[model samples]
Structures are given as C-alpha cells and as structure tokens.
Target: MKKTVKILSLFLIVLTVMISCKKDTDPADKDFFVGTYKGSVSYNKSGQSITSSDGRVTVSKIGETYSFYFGNNIPDITGVKFEKSGDNNYVSVGSGLTGITINASSLKMLVNKDGATWTADCSR
Candidate 1:
C-alpha cells in the first residue's frame, strides 16, 4: 500500500508540473499577430481610389505567408511574406519604399504592387 501511494504521488506531481508548464511562443509566430485592426485605409488602382476612415484590416497567417484582408471593399493583399524586424515586430519582405510593419497592437502598410497602391494606418 505504501509503494502504491508513493507511485500515485509521483504521478500526481508529474501531472501538476506538466499542467503548469506551457510552451514558449515566439512573437514572430502567426498566433501573436493575427487579429483585426481598425483605422484609416486606402487603395488606389488605375486611377480608381477607395478610402475609408473606419476601415479595418484582418490579419491572417498560413504557413509562412500572411494576408491582410481590408474592409470597405478594398482589395486584399494576400500571400505576403514577413521577416522579423524587432523583438515583437515583423516587416514585409520587399522594397524599402513600400512595405508593411506589424506588431501585436498595430499595423502600418504602404504597398505598391502590380499598379495598385494600398495604404493603412490601423491599430487594435
């Protein structure tokens, strides 16, 4: 009976430790940055422009690619790759003039690609 009690205690201790411990998540991971931000957003393409002061951008990630889904009928920017920029920030991998910066609380984008320009200054 004493041996059985010791084994049960050991199992309980191990179970408690396992339950208390959590895996460390990297800030650059998709789960850290996927959310919705609201603010101004604009898009211009081929002389047509759309702007909204109450715009929203929903960020989603799949594998290594991140997508920005713009509200107000603005076109979505999909399959963009980002590189870690700081402790908790990621920036789009592209030319210096047009890129995106994203963190836990904010997102800023100024991208011009394929004759379309998209701008956003949003925060959660």
Candidate 2:
C-alpha cells in the first residue's frame, strides 16, 4: 500500500508540472502568423490582472499598425503589418504580446519573457 501511494504521488506531481509548463508550440498547416507584434497590453503583476484589451500587429509596406483585440465585442485584426528580424524572429512595437511569429501561420505565438519567450496562440 505504501509503495502504491508513493507512486501515485509521483505521478500526480509529474502530471502537474507537465500541464503547467506547456508553452512551446509549432504552427499548424494553415496558419498565416509570423513576426513580433506589439499589442496595447499591461498586466498588473501585483494583482495578476490584464489591464489592456487591444494591441497592434504590423500591417504592411507603409509601416502602418492594426489592432488585435483580446476582449469581447472587438474584432480580430486583419491586414496586420509585420517586419522580419535577424533569424526566425520579428517585432511590431506598440502594445502587449510584442514578439509574434511573422514567418508562418498558426494559432500560437511567442511572447518575450525577459531573455526567453513564451508561447501564445490566437483562440477563435
């Protein structure tokens, strides 16, 4: 009984870690997302809240910006502007989720977390 209990605890711990640390992702077959996009977002670290609702994505040859909203009643952006960087990376600066993928299309993206980046996908 004790041995079984110990194994169960270990399994639970490993499962929790696996579920919590799921951030890395590759794009699906039909995703059109690439580049680093900056959205107007600020998290209240103290309270752990999302303060902003909308952010910008790069739109085109003229360097114009478009809005990609995370809140309700707002439309997802179309014709966003994006720029390529040194190696498989891009940046569109304006708001939150600043570093997005510009080379491929997918539901998930990467956001800068200090030195490393976090993966985030668009959910529709």
Candidate 3:
C-alpha cells in the first residue's frame, strides 16, 4: 500500500508539472499573419510618391523571409525578416530605421530602405 501511494503521488506530480508548462511558439513557423490587409498605404522614392486610401497589403512567408505585396502600383517589399515581439506581435529585423510590426489582426509599416519609403496602416 505504501509503494502504491508513492507511485501515485509521483504520477500526480509529473502530471501537474506538465499541465502548468506553456509551449513557446515561433511566429515564423506558422502563417498566422499571412493574409491581405486593407487600409491606407503609400510609397515614395526619389521625387515620386504613390498613395492610396483603399490599399491592400498581402503578407506572405517563405521560410524565415516575408514579403509584402502592396497595391496601387507600389513596389513590393521582399526579403524581409521578423523577430517575435511582445506576446502576439512580430517586428521586422533590419539594420536601418525600418519599423514593420505585424500581428494576427493588423499590420503597420513605416519602412525606409535604399532611398525608398513605404508606409502602411492596414488590418485583416
């Protein structure tokens, strides 16, 4: 009876530990943000600029890289990488002053690279 009690207690302790543990998930491993967002989007390079109020930005992921397909004839932003930020956000990784924050419901971008600027405020 003592041996049975010890075994049962050990099983209960292990089960409690497993139940309390949380799994850490990587955002890049899934396409949670891979969809089309619609709102305002703009792009500027040199002296030319393009803006649209009814714009769309499609998010796609291939491996660890992400691409942003913009509407309104704006050039697409490709080869972008992101790191997980906060609990449910992914922010772009780059050396420049690029800021692209993405979540399951929204996408915001103010990226400037290679003398070009892209701005977006969109939601799925």
Best by TM-score: 3
Better structure of 2 and 3 per TM-score = 3
* Top of the candidates by lDDT: 3
What are the per-residue Cα lDDT tens digits for candidate 3 across 23-123? 33233556432567889999999999999999999877767788898889999988888888887888999776369998767789999988999999987
* Cα lDDT tens digits for candidate 1, 1-119: 99999999999977754443223323255333356788999999999999999899987765777788988889888878788876888888855334899876778998988888999
Score each candidate by Cα lDDT. Answer: 0.77, 0.40, 0.79
lDDT of 2 at 109: 45
Candidates in order, TM-scores: namely 0.71, 0.27, 0.72
The pairs that clash in candidate 1 are none
Model 2 root-mean-square deviation:
14.6
Q: What lDDT score is found at residue 75 in candidate 1? A: 85
**Residue lDDT tens for model 2, 1-124:** 9999999999997875454323332112113322333434333333344433344333222124433433422223433445556554445554454665543332234454433333334322
Two-way TM-score contest, 1 vs 3, winner:
3
Model 1 worst lDDT window (10 residues):
18-27
